[model samples]
Target: MSHPRNTLRTSTFSCTWCRVSVPVATADGGQRNHCPACLHSRHVLDQVTGGPSTCLGAMSPIAIAVPRAGDWTVVHRCVRCDELACDAVREDDNQLVVMRMAVRPLAQPPFPLEAFGTL
Candidate 1:
């Protein structure tokens, strides 16, 4: 038998990458899409079409984006289809993982950072 919606909301899902069981809801009662440990998610929704996706691939956390006036967002890329998606970063997410992604571009820039100093 199918479970109720409320029960499903409180259920836990195993992370596709870390294999850790995570709750669907956060401590602030917000829904979560990625695992807090590895910050990996599944490609189940289409960002371009705003509908369900069929790729069903493993999405790895690639970068961190910050809006003008909002919380940080974790960017993911699907391994199978190369589709991209972003999700809000939860308060309990791993700070180390988030920081690493945020500083990646700076840590390994395409061009020399010293060039910007001349400009």
Candidate 2:
């Protein structure tokens, strides 16, 4: 039996930072761009064109954004090219890593918390 040319194969990729092998498809049938173990991604797709990008840089998880719809997204910044991209959070993603990114800004606030007291 011959398979179709466009047959979907089990896609897996290695994490750029942690070197963990991860599957491209999540358990809930959603596409995953970041590694579940380290929450790191690679600069592979063009955010504007929705096509393959030539910048093969290591994308580090910078922040977590919760949309009005309430779904959390992991924002990544490329180390080499400085491109930014966001990907949906997977169910199996590491909670500690996600939480750390979410609270990073608050942990090291640019402005003093005492300023809020005056408000």
**Residues 26-54, model 2: lDDT tens digits:** 88888888899999899999888999999
For residues 34-93, write the lDDT of model 1, one tens digit per residue.
Answer: 999999999999889999998899999998999999999999999999999989999999
TM-score of 1: 0.87
CA lDDT scores, all candidates in order: 0.90, 0.86
Give candidate 1's root-mean-square deviation (CA, Å).
2.5
Error of 1 at 55 (Å): 1.5
Instruction: Name the regions of candidate 1 deviating beyond 4 angstroms.
Output: 1-9, 115-119
